[model samples]
Target: MSKGRILIRNGHVIDTEPQPVAHAHTDVLIEGGKITAVGRNLRSKGAMVIDATDRIVLPGFVDTHRHVWHSALRSAAIDIDLGAYFRLLGQVGPKFRPQDVRIATLAGALECLDAGITTQLDFAHIAYSPELANAAVDALKEAGLRAVFAYGTPVNVTAGGKLADVRRIRERLADDNALVTMAYAPLGPLSTPMETVARDWRIADELDLPLTIHLASSPNNEQPIFALREAGLLREKTLYVHANGIGDDELKLIADSGATASATPGDEAGRLRRAGITTGTGIDTVAFAPGDMFSTMRAAHLAGQIAEDPQLTAKDVLRMATLDGAAAMGLADRTGSLRPGKQADVILLRLDDLNMLTAERDPIGAVVTEAQPHNVDTVLVAGKVVKAGGRLVHADLRRTARALRATAAAISGR
Candidate 1:
């Protein structure tokens, strides 16, 4: 984690915390993989200088929930709905070997970095074996991205796959530091039996790892938030992903239990709408949802505005992508902000990009509104440059894409 001194000079910094936020023309000094200072004209001797002029420096985006393994299969689910996705993955997943997992993880991780997602909670369900699990972890390390490898318990929970296996993986990866962390990803309560879920939660509690589950809305099964509450299972480390249209009682219980929630609005909004257009359950959607976190932010903002409860400011909307997301992963102390003591996981987006030609004056507005991945000029993870000059470092984009296609072809027996 000891990335050497990096002096980012003369960039407008959107430091989202500790008052006096969003300074213009600020210099940031990073040392030993941590932010050392943020001020005007800061200098560090013998530091690697990065020209951040004409760029807006912000804490890199954090994605609270993502199935990163699918990076190898980009747009695979784009045309399909929730049911088709389940069917497709169910058929193709078993054919993937360890090498495939490694390639997919690395590709996915790079995609996140390229998109300016500095920290990601990668819900890795493909690692049914330890070798596969280690492969995913290794790829994350090699990608030099900050990630939480949310280890999923196996399909055959009756056999070798258990919390002990997770513990063993943790022991194997004991050397992993802040750059690559661990999490407990288990089948949600509605999917698995309550007894098994109870055991998994107990194991996660004993291990003191954050637990994330997809409490997705399904009419086929009765909502289980009340059941989880009755079972005394909710905790601060508990994160419910994409619990859209959840009842007020469930939301209140989740809040009272000190649990967190995350929304991958792209997947949810798209799935619902696509399902409506397709053969699956045509769930009603009030607003048209697109495929980015910005759309998610917009959805949340609109919801808050419509309710007249608490209208979100630009900062409030941005916090869901930054501090709140890190809090969901229990990583708020490290990588979420641009604090002096935090890890130097930062990104610079070019305000000079074509998308920004008609941009608003508010920095945070652009971040939560119009900024695209192509606008990412530079990205640093743990103070190391993983993306520079709007291109991913240490990557052969064309070759990687080709390899991914070959992988898909092999999987499909083409």
Candidate 2:
């Protein structure tokens, strides 16, 4: 399919763009990979018509940060904290061959698509060699998911040693309009020298790529952003992941510098959002949490509700999973909403599903609070139907499952 026309008719449409709004019994028309119209009874001749009755039509979710290379190790470190998780990575990270990395990355991207995530920023830090880096990029391109492949230093490896490989991968993925783009993922001042961080930032700037970093996840790292600010490296096109445990002043600085923040489950995403920052939701690692945005949204909402302010509502988290997430990834102009001019990254959820049958009164709340990946009935990326009738349209699941199992066994030495 070469970005053909699509007409999704008569559904409950929800979108967060310009502003969050919902429309009932509306139609959305997509042509040449872009949404051309969104209204009642829209007509598009020769378009592939999809009946969306009893479905919730919305822009597909955007995951701002995910270590996609960890897919084969799902639940391996489920009970560990951040420190132990890194230690686990040090143990298993070196065991993965380039083929294994490709399998894990492809599996992870497919998982994202199955859960209605049309776009993701893959915080891929398993690129231990040039072969491994190329393999990971190959996997993303093969999976056909829109992604920002944020290349980074491997765990248990020397930080900033892979800058040249980052450039190489950037050169390979130079087409920004393609599904797979490139970014730089650096171990910020917390785990690397300021000099190394500067080098990483300069390489990223030279490549004209975005920079994403793990910052303020621990108390010792809470001040790394300030250091970046002092070094004059803090700027837009940067995503501060795990802005957890940071103070209001730091949040203000991030907001002022036009930088965005992303938080996994149980982080201060709500705080960042409240401080006028563009806070996106991240699955972070599937090693400990569900990969789907529905679970991530619920976790984020709970994190906010338990906070003193309790101002993060269900709709707010939905935005974090959608438009805000795209903004965090610096691709809001192309995706993140059902806006007429945006790319057609959309999904349909079966509102009549058992879990959502009676939740029509607050559809957005239902999506944020009650929906699950199983409720996703159809998905489209760039006007191409990748999923329909509650199943992936082009995936070879049996083959993928076999490869994943083999990769896991090989990695675990089982």
**Which candidate should be chosen as best, given TM-score against the real structure?**
2
User: What's model 1's overall lDDT?
Assistant: 0.72
Q: How many residue pairs clash in each candidate?
A: 0, 0
TM-score of 2: 0.97
| Model 2 Cα lDDT, one tens digit per residue, 207-260 | 999889887635445587788888998799899888756778888999999999
RMSD in order of candidates: 5.9, 1.4
Listed in order, each prediction's TM-score against the native is: 0.87, 0.97
Stretches of candidate 1 off by over 4 Å are 18-20, 153-160, 217-221, 266-311, 358-360
What range of 10 consecutive residues in model 2 has the weakest lDDT sum?
216-225
